[model samples]
Target: MFRTENALILREVRFKESDRILTALTADAGKMTLAAHGALSKHSRIAAATQQLTYAELTLFEKNGRYTVREGVTKEGFPGLRQDLGKLALGSYFAECLEQYAGEDQPEPELMQLGLNSLYALSEGLGSCEKIKAAFELRLMTLEGYAPAEESCPVCGRGDIREPVFLPEEGQTVCRACRKAGRSLPLTENALAAMRHILHAPAKKLLAFRLTEEEQSLLSAVAESWLLHCSDRNFPTLAYYRNLKL
Candidate 1:
């Protein structure tokens, strides 16, 4: 059987000497692993489309419950991301996040769209890497049904919140009174507004927010801790991105 779909190449690993294994996020089928023969060769047509972060239309042949890539035509490779190490690492981190949340044969179009939009923002330099990463993490958590409550402090129910503190493990924002309970980070009003925008902004307007350097750092801290707490695991690409001075 043959099937065709639009997919983004999240990862590519060499199979034998010439063939490659592709980890793709398909618009119609979510995540899938497809084998591409002769993909390592310089003359291979599918080479460009098989590279990580390549959004392409793929044709695959299936037999015995396995899918093999027959052809791939590239759509968007976000070439600008490749021009900078930081952007490339961030893009890789996005791919890894998608790989973790997406499941085989399950359609998650919103997640796919979010990933594509984030790559576009990185490619176009829409925002600073820290802002982009924080926004992506917060919004992604919301999409995965782990959004942090922002209405009031979950502990004190104080609606007029001042100097909010976020508890990552609890996925809640608390008032200043609750900060001493354990390891918690300050979530400034600006940072809280940023998270709120990420959780509620329209799809096309997701990357439109602006923030000061201080607010950006606060948001990054809260976002990183929240994502880490929710996932309960660290991603290698994220670790590398964090280590970079950029």
Candidate 2:
């Protein structure tokens, strides 16, 4: 049977000489692998749409629980994301995060929207890369149902978080009165505000906030820590993104 879906190519691997295999996150089907015949060869229709970071509409032939691309139409290749090493690395990081969190055949529309919106922000140069990454990380977690408690300290119920402390593994914010020694990362008020904005803002306004360098650093730390603790795996793409000279 033939099944068509709108998807983002999260990963692509060369297969044999001219064929390629793609790991794609579909808007309706979650994540799945699609084989592109002759994608490496000249004059192949599916070639452009099969590249990593390309978002496309794919028509696939499925049998025995596997999918092969019959045709593909490119929607957004996010060209601007490739213009700079930093943006490219960050885009890869976002793709890797989606690959980890999205499941096969388990439709996650919100997550798909989050990924597409983030790529759009990056591709359009709408904000600082650090701000975009921080927003994406926090919002991705929130969409996955692991959002940090930002209204008050989970342990002490303290509403005043002038100096907020975030516990990554627990997915909670802690007040000074409830902080366990060595158990939290210090979050500046701006960092706290950034996270709140990411989780609560309108879809069009999620990346509307700005951050100072110091706040960006703190938010990056907390976001990365929470992602690592929740994912419990090393993301090489993220590591590479971090090591690049920004």
Candidate 3:
């Protein structure tokens, strides 16, 4: 059967000499692994659309539960990312996260939107890289049903946590008075406010808020730690991105 879908190419591996295998996140099919014949050849038509992080409309043929790309047209190649190594690394990290967490053969429109928005933000330089990273991490976790309770301290039921410290394992914030001995990252008031905004804001307004350098650092640390804890795996792309930043 032949069908069409809009998909983001998350990862690609060389198959044989000229063919390619792609891990794609589709708007309707969630995640799919697709085979693209001759994608590596110099004269291949679909090569550009099949590149990692390219968002494209793909014509696919499915048989025996396997998919092959018959045609592909790029929707948004995010050209700006390639010119800047930092943005490219961060964009690659986003792709890795989506490939890891998005469910296969399930519709995940919201997650798809988040991934697109994140890449667009990076490609367009819409916000500070740190801010974008923090927002994406927190929002992705929320979409996966692991949203942290930023509204109140879980232990004391206090809506106003003046001295907030985030517990990654528990996926919640607590007042310093209620903090225990496990891993906890302290949050400044600005960092806490940013976290709340990230969790509740709409897609377009996700990075609307501002933060000082110190506050951004705090938020970045919290967001990364929380996501790693919830996902229970470390991403090599994330490590590479961090190394690039350093």
* Candidate 3 per-residue C-alpha lDDT over 183-237 given as tens digits, one digit per residue, 9 for 90 to 100: 9998988899999999999988999989899989899999999989988988999
Q: List, residue by residue over 49-123, the lDDT tens digit for candidate 2.
A: 899999998999999998999899999999998898899999999999999999887887887888999998999
- Each candidate: RMSD to true structure? 1.2, 1.5, 1.0
Give the higher-lDDT candidate: 1 or 3. 3
Q: Which residues of candidate 3, in runs, are more than 4 Å off?
A: none
Better of 2 and 3 by TM-score: 3
> How far in Å is the alpha carbon of 217 misplaced in model 1?
0.6
lDDT of each residue in 25-48, candidate 1, tens digit only: 987788999999998998999888
Return model 1's CA RMSD, one decimal: 1.2
Query: Could you give me the TM-score of model 3 versus the true structure?
Result: 0.97
Q: Which 10-residue span in candidate 2 carries the lowest summed lDDT?
A: 174-183
Among these predictions, the greatest TM-score belongs to: 3
* lDDT (C-alpha) at residue 180 in model 2: 83
Worst 10 residues of 3 by lDDT: 153-162
